[model samples]
Target: MNHSATAMAFRASARRTLTLEQQAIGELIAKLDSSFDSACQELLACRGRIIVTGMGKSGHIARKMAATLASTGSPAFYVHPGEASHGDLGMITGDDVVVALSNSGETQEITGLMPLFKRLGARLISLTGRPGSTLARYSDVHVDVGVSREACPHDLAPTSSTTAALAMGDALALALLESRGFSAEDFALSHPGGTLGKRLLLRVRDLMHGDERLPCVPAGSPLREALLEMTRQGMGFTCVVDERGALVGVYTDGDLRRTLDQRGDFSLLRVDDVMTRGGKTVAPDTLAAEAVRLMEDSRISALAVVEDGKPIGALHMHDLLRSGVI
Candidate 1:
């Protein structure tokens, strides 16, 4: 066959798999009932973390599910079922709850450790295909993650089952999150390494150009002197300060443009005369993202960073854009 024919065949296969998976996901959504509530109850009752465990392909899904739970207000971690027999069982504590994943519901490693989970006072929630299996029989809560067939052509691989399990796990997490009134700040605390973390955790003080980098001139300073100060700092603006260095007004490129548009005499004006007095300013403790929000709201590109009425620094929208916060 030609390259285009092969590509078309591959696309056809992919489309079929995606359609099947979407249908399977809808089936899983319809299956949410009392069992899901009971499982959430057992988890919420736990005084400790949620311990997720599975074997092989299911283990990979379990690990990711655990991470999602941890980041979304539920503390969770993955423990390999095979490794549990090899002294890792110590990781599961009495106060914790175990979420075990197995498509067949009869995996040797998981079945062997089912009693241990209960014996340690840790309640077991089983996600499996066979509801009548021993693991499900002993489980305090059974969530049927049964999939008719996998996306794989062979129909034996764990594709559809893993996808269903992941979707179900997300459903459970988000439901619990809503019930518990979890907030974005809580989510950001868990995702400190990602872009969301930088936006939520970083403050105006954290990124502001301060001290030596501040562009400013005295309130009585000449317009030409303020222009020189703006040039020296390269902020395209200069703040006008009182005798005690308190922020009184600001002069910017836009202000200069407007001043020019008015056909005003620059030589006759002072920084205080041409500057915008009592301009909007932000506190040093404000969040950088909040600063960006304020700037966007006020339709301004640059702002004076002030603390206790004194201009301490300056910030530009370009700084936020470069930092991936905008």
Candidate 2:
């Protein structure tokens, strides 16, 4: 075929595949019934971990399903059905729920384990394209993930079927997540190395410069003294405190700009004359993410970490950036 015809052919094929997968997912919305609810209830009621199993392409989908369930507050893991016959069947127990994925509902490797699953008293939940197949009949809850056709021209490859099954798995994971009142903080606990965890788990105390690193000036100190402290700490600001070591105000870069604009004599002015009284502050225990919001809202770059009306630490926007809380 000509180059133009070849490009047209590729585009047509891509469109067909996307259209079929979209339809497959859309059909699942209509097909959702009490069975989906029962599956969620069974999973929620399970006292032991959720065991997901399948073979070949179905096994790949099962692994992802298990990971999603595990990350979303449900305890789950994937076990290969073929390996189960060899010895991995010991991984399952009577209290657990077994989620099996088989597009045909007749894979020998999975069907062969049905009697054992029953004998072990583990509840079976099956996702299969064939509702009347053996696996579905044996399952305690059968979710029909059947698609009318595959995206494949030969109607053989697992295209639309796998997409539908994946969508169903996501639906189950999120439904159970909501029913269990799983919060973002709970999700963050499982993902401590990711950006979301840094935002949710990090506090001002974790990122603030405290103790000897804190920059401070007495209320009546020279403006030059505060500027020196700001330069020495390299935090762009200095806390102004009373003789009792209580925070009275804050002197920042903005304050410096205004002092310069006024063309005041550096030798005669006290830090209190130009400092902002009771500037934006956060408790040491406050979430760093919340501090980010306050800084963005106030259009400031630094905050004094205060406790018991005393400046305990100082935080800068760069600190948050380094910690990945931004």
State the lDDT of candidate 2 residue by residue for 197-297, as single tens digits. Answer: 99999999999999889999899999889999999998889999998999999999999999998865677898998899999999999999999999999
* RMSD value for candidate 1: 2.3
Q: Point out where model 1 deviates above 4 Å.
A: 242-246, 258-265, 296-300, 307-310, 321-326
TM-score of 1: 0.91
Among residues 3 or more apart in sequence or in different chains, the pairs in candidate 2 whose N, CA or C atoms overlap within 3 Å are none
Give per-residue lDDT, candidate 1, residue 248: 89
Report how far off residue 316 is in candidate 2 (Å): 1.4
Tell me the TM-score of each prediction against the true structure.
0.91, 0.96
Model 2 misplaced regions, further than 4 Å: 1-8
